[model samples]
Target chain A: MGVRIQMPLSLRERIGMEEMVEVEGDTVGRCLEDLTRKWPELKGELLDPNGRLLLRWTIYLNGRPPSSSEELEQYVSEGDIITLLPLVDGG
Target chain B: MEREIPGGYNGRILRVDLSRERIDQVDLDASLCRRLLGGAGFIAYFLLKELPQGTDPFGPENKLVFASGPLTGIPLGGCARHTVGAKSPLTGGIAKSEAGESWGPQLKRAGFDALIVEGRAHRPVYLWIHDGDAEIRDASSLWGKETRETQEKIREEVGEARASLAMIGPGGENLVRYACIMHGCFDAAGRGGLGAVMGSKNLKAVAVRGDRMPPLKDPQAVKRMAAWLKDHMDLVKAFSDYGTGSPMPRFEQVGNLPVRNFRDGGFPQVERITPQTIKGTIRVGMKGCFACPVQCKKEVEFREPYHVDRIYGGPEYETLAALGSACGIDDLKAISKGSERCNAYSIDTISTGMSIAFAMECFENGLLTLEDTGGLELRFGNAEAMLEMIERIARREGLGALLAEGTVRAAQRIGKGTEAYAMHVKGQELPMHEPRLSKALGLGYMVNPHGADHMDSMIDLFFSAFTAQPTVAVPDLIPLGMEPAPLDDIGPRKVALFKAFQAKRIVADSLVLCHFLPYSFSQVAEITSAVTGWETTPMEQIRVSERILTLCRLFNLREGITDEADRLPERFFYPTQDGPLAHRSLSPDEMERAKRYYYRLLGWDDRGVPTPERLEELGISELEG
Candidate 1:
């Protein structure tokens, strides 16, 4: 089993309109790297030049943010869900 | 007449005294425009100057000002907006709310910067305004009509098929305390019970028609701004594509969405009602206001479970959260139907949904009984009961009569320790944003003059370390010297940032600009200069915004809404039951300290009153006398 990466509708266009994609990785960073490798165009959309998650996006591991000090290095198990959602400003 | 008035102005204010059946034109003062700008600024000035202290909000003495700014009718995107202000029947304080559509621009084009409505009409009446003229016509036939029907009938009667209307529905006619003024069929000045004030006057609607555009000082500059917005549509693609409720799941993840009367933090079912789901299931089209290119306004239609018309528009983020997650109902169709009913009846979705949520919680806790809800199970996740409650609230029937007064008063009337469940600040029901996740916003909820307004201040998450980057910096706050602060910081630095952001927000309201648009302060200053030919700057606009806010504070204080009323609800001071912010809660002491610091930053004394010295600095010291 692999980790399923869920993307918000705002970013689905870059990934051929797929709401969620599955990839194999043990860490959040590796999963995102695999996601970018598959889509190619999502690298700039999801990450900055420093290879960090863009400020506009938040990552949730199974509906909650990872509790580790290093969010990108948080370990994941098989069949875990990684969701990326854009930051909403106002009501 | 054109030469005497400044550019972007008609140099006229329509004054309608319904009591006397008298109509008069008051010349717009150039000085007032220079000092207070317009919209919220004009409302603050007129309400304070004319309204007596302790006047009953629904009494004949209360006044309603519908105002547009210099930027209105200038062919710019996001400029088709207006502010409606009065003494709120809901909060009993300064009431100001803004709406976007064609009505504000039509009002400006009809040869007035603002319309001041006062006194109760002897009978139901609707004002028909055309190019540089006005008439009050009998609206007895239109008294109990819904918003869409009223619009159609008024347009037919006036023989102006294109005339824009601002009208009320049964919710207003019945004087539900949270009734909103519906503009067009979709847009609403949806806070502070301004519609109840309209209802009290026996006024049904105001129909405006005109082709006369206010001459711009630099037409090319205005055109360039419009073109710039058109060219940069990519900047707002998400809004254009999915509209406001597109980020529901994100809001849930961050613990910002109000769940189950703000008692819980997690609503895993939020994905069911997001804009994407709506688009996939029921959305028919996307529309825009006046010259706006973004077209963020959503139009939805469905006939399966409930017949929801597109004319009433679809639910935005606030509506979705208030009616969906807050009530613990994930039935998207029911939520959409509730939204449609609110638009039809002209009640505020936020307050209506929140009131229902409060009642549901109270009922669950045994404070209310089946007998109290008239045999209805007023419980959370009871979508049928929630839908029925919306209708009941609008018509002020049975339990709705208590809820019609809004949660603060309703809890008092219930009197079974239900006050703790009433999540509100002052008398206004809190919007969907959770203050625990964004501490500065919590402080904003406490100290905002009108009470619990999310639009008046910046959300802390936007400025938190998670999202603070040079590329994604908020254009408006950067010019005001704002920097990133921790999301939970309710200290001096956060208060300072809140003060600056509040000033910018007030400027947007004064200009009647749409908050969704990404306009920098300098860009706004440039637009103002282009329209009015004034040598304006960002700092000058900030100062003017401060003046308007101070004036609103004075009006509220004069009406006995003191600094003591500046506080959050009890729910926010405690942690949510679960979610990302399950362990988080706002410290009451820190909030109090932050509020004091904010007062000092705004040059207000410890009592939250603008000091005489500060009033002098703002150039409104004469009002203090």
Candidate 2:
């Protein structure tokens, strides 16, 4: 399945300047794993020491956040679009 | 009290009774100092006890507290910050806004940890402080003057070119509900109508110049700490390079930036107002607060239709979002001019922009006619109209008077479903951040005593990092019995994290530290202990923060800001029209549950009111309204 993954400019600059990429995965986790495999530089930035999805990199699947029950283990469908947003700190 | 107790504090508070034209110095007890710390802590305690319940916010009964913290004036980065607090005329609740500039440190060096002004003066006046001494001078000549001219006049008259002044302008004098107090020319206690409280007291300005250096517990240790922090200068270089503007492009990318009065999730013209564009266009240089190495203040010199004064400083992220994208105006020059006018007139740029955006929406809906807008276009993306509205609001001309009333009250006056379009919480206009993108911030906005303040709690973005990255926040979270929760979850775990960070933010504000400063909880505790010799710990400081927060909540409850009033506008619960959050709106039931969970953690009842046991635990006295 082709899942469209969108990256923020901050991450896009570090990941070969591609605005969006298509990766194969049936679940959100696998999709992210595929993304990191494609752009190895994103591995450290998008995951914790435990190798779990980084919380700060907000992921919107199809223009909406995953429901609480799903979290990162949420299932994905073909043509699903996921946006990776960097952490924005406030004053 | 011992003659000169500790390193961090001056051990005295200057109390000014403007009505009697009397000045008195009161000793700050060590116990109180240890308990409340300073800044927002002191203000909350004082306001809760002294301000009578239901007292008119603009009356003499409402007191204004200008306080500095233990860390202030200690040659530490971000110590230049301080707080101005009062019973807000807009929110009708406790209002504490922190500002960064030279004024707080100067006031600290002038031998006072806090300055409390009460009672209204019979005539216009200004307070002058020089090296622990104080005097009241007639400000009749300085009345109605802009902040820049007032600061200039005060400096010249006081014969101290280095004097730091906090003054108000026509907006304040006219009692604009969201008026701010300008520090020197640019920095401001810009939320909650504090300037109006100053105007109500008939006080025009506060000028201070002090030569006495603050006594530190271990001068060598303080210097060593400063050096250590400065060694990591690269951490803040981006801030130094672009000020708060460094975060704009990132915020835009995240859909956190409020666009087109929050109807849209993204602004296509964001590239025009990014830090790079600002630096390339008119940025002359950068400025810094006292003893700060970051120098995150950008200076812009303008020409032609938007001849912004360099002294008034350049637009930061909030200004850029509020005046630039929020209004759907892509013209950076117009935003710059609007920002300059806001500074010059001593009004809040956030409130002003939000008010204009609300009016523009009304115009779009045909609720407002050309007759109402005085023939101005009053349309979204109309840069000229935006600039014109800023000036008009400052002068209270035509539609300006209604706009100056703020979005909440303005909507009431311009009824016909306009309230539905007014984007505000408890009458104070929302800042640049979008709630749908950051759930925790939205919750903070609803429950914050000051109403819709981003600084009241740690934003969700940081929490997201804490969950995923687990680096900086892990150590801080250890003491609070928390680990990061999932970003989309608003369950008990996330609520706990929110409460912990809220406590930390309270400590930051009370310490008078800048939000931009990267001070870990442990580091803050270490610095406080090193300066005050009080053996402060992170856990103990957090307890104090909890107490401070409870006191503020008590004040709010007493002032009639009930649970019903603690809510986001209808618009926030509606999905955005575009971008990542195109079909996303904060779920009201989930938000309510989050609020309830947070309250429960604080030992408050279901109504969000502090219980008797909670008050006893926090050492807060309940004031019966």
Candidate 3:
């Protein structure tokens, strides 16, 4: 079973999905790697060419941030909900 | 004009009589100029000496004062902000607020410290200022356009892209009750619907480009202030790095950021939309406003087509709250889109979003129907629906037209118990903070001369008392730092003291300091002394700040507002689902006690009016005349 990786509110339109983003990976990094592999539209939305998570993006594994020790495969379950949030700001 | 190259000002105030189609210049009294600084201070003097009473807010008699303070046009964390004060069309009272960077400093250096536009224009007109000279030119060509277009048009007309433009949109022209006055294309004087006031005057926009530097009293003083400011480079970095969104987690974690229009502020989606989320998703590069070091204004781009797949202003916390979860929209893209529309249409995001939220709640509760919405579901969380509504509101079309009247009025129209859900305090929608979580902020909203605004005196950040502290989920989450003043210890006296202090600091910040400077009193005091000769003693500074607050109160009072207006929305007064503060509010007894304490401390009568004694204390005894 794979996990679902969703784009944040700000980038959801470009990626074309608000939720249920299916991806294959075993760690947070791999999950993102898989996420970009499928929804290539969001590559620049979340990371630079080097694949570093942009300063404004944060990830949640099953409603909570993944534990430091847990890799993508360590916690990958069929129905895991991985949410991506962006920090778009101005008043 | 009196020229004092260093002490405080550039020595000139620009005045435009739209009815006469003439622009005049005057010198600001130097001694009073230093003490008052800029922005609100200048507005105060203008209101007293020039903008006489009996003048209609919309008629040719009203005055608009835009001034940058002594500390403006400098390279500080708090960049210079221009102030706009005139009799408010929304509340039918005096309204004064700070419009940020791009316009204020340039207007000041162009050889004028203040710009006062008075009288109604004979035709659609925009002001063009080059250096000290300003002219009210025919803007018929500029009519029937949006703010962004107006900016571009003015740029082409003036032949300078560097010029500053503050304009209104169709919403303003139609006189939407909560329209905004947008400057620098992003920032705004978003409350009191000042844009509507501008529209009523048939004023189109004011564009300025100047080539002059400020006259510092002491170059060493300027250098020392700059050096001292450099010492706090870490905070400066943090603020710039995060822009104002850094506070998203703090407010969300603390339960301060209002969600659902102060209805249940704890959005399960908070973590997803935090500043970290913004930084990772759409931020392309760091952007600054004018000469600001802590460039908090972000230019966010939404790629691809959804609702807001274009370039425009990014979403600040207030905008996110206003357009996001407040209306059940969790998508960051939609929030950014909403912010952009507000700027494009020149309307207040807080009010417009709340207006939509108000509509959503009514429809969801079955109080409103599809027929009422003219086929649009008007459902919460519908991004497409929101986009249509924003356009409609700006054009005053269909359901959008109904909502453009504002939440308070719309709720009243939608009957069937919708009033209970209307999230307005004194006809203005609550701006993005759940005051129940923060009593100081609650009190600030209660006492804010302009309806429920967090900008006036957001003491909630420092005191940290009333912020939402989720006890069960995050056990280590304590709302405040080590030593926070408690509600009782911070009785009405201390609360008033804190409120007054924050108001003064706000006056300074609103005029000069960046809203995100986030300094303690000691830091602000140090900066104020180094730049200008005005020394803010611990006690005296706090009191003087309180005095400035009282002046705002007096301005409102003179314009016919009173104690009954000091209020939190009835919704915030009760609990939908209690987490932190519980189902507790200031009981009628407690509220009375707090009000009495505040009144006594300020020497005001129980009615919240400034007593004659209070005016005398502030050396404005003649204001009663």
User: Model 3 over residues B504-582: C-alpha lDDT tens digits?
Assistant: 5555643466655545455555556665555654345555555556766777777667888877677766764543444
Clash count of each predicted structure: 0, 3, 28
Give lDDT tens digits, candidate 2, residues B1-625.
3344577888889999998899999998766677788999999988988998888989998899999988877888988988999999888899989888899999998999999999999988999998999999999998889998999998999999999998999889889889999997889899999998999999999998887767778777777778877865544555766677555554665677898888888776787886668888889999989999989887888787757899999888889889889999888888888888899999999999999999998999899999999999899999999989988898889999999889989888999999998888888899888888777778888888899888775566544443243332333566557776666566777778777777777887888787666666787888888888878788898789878878888889887788887789988888888875788888899989988888888888999888888877876655423
| Higher-scoring candidate on lDDT, 1 or 3 | 1
Question: Candidate 1 clashing pairs?
Answer: none
- Write model 1 residue lDDT over B222-261, tens digit each, in one string: 8888887786554566677778855566678778889999
What is the TM-score of each candidate's chain B when compared with the real chain B? 0.98, 0.97, 0.90
**Candidate 1 residue spans exceeding 4 A from truth:** A1-88, B1-4, B466-475
Better of 2 and 3 by lDDT: 2
Residue A29's lDDT within candidate 3 is 70
Highest-lDDT candidate: 1
* Candidate 1, residue B165: lDDT: 92
Task: Give all candidates' CA lDDT scores.
Answer: 0.86, 0.82, 0.67
* Per-candidate alpha-carbon RMSD to the true structure: 5.8, 7.4, 10.2
Judge candidate 2 at residue B567 and give its lDDT. 89
Task: Give the candidate number with the greatest TM-score.
Answer: 1
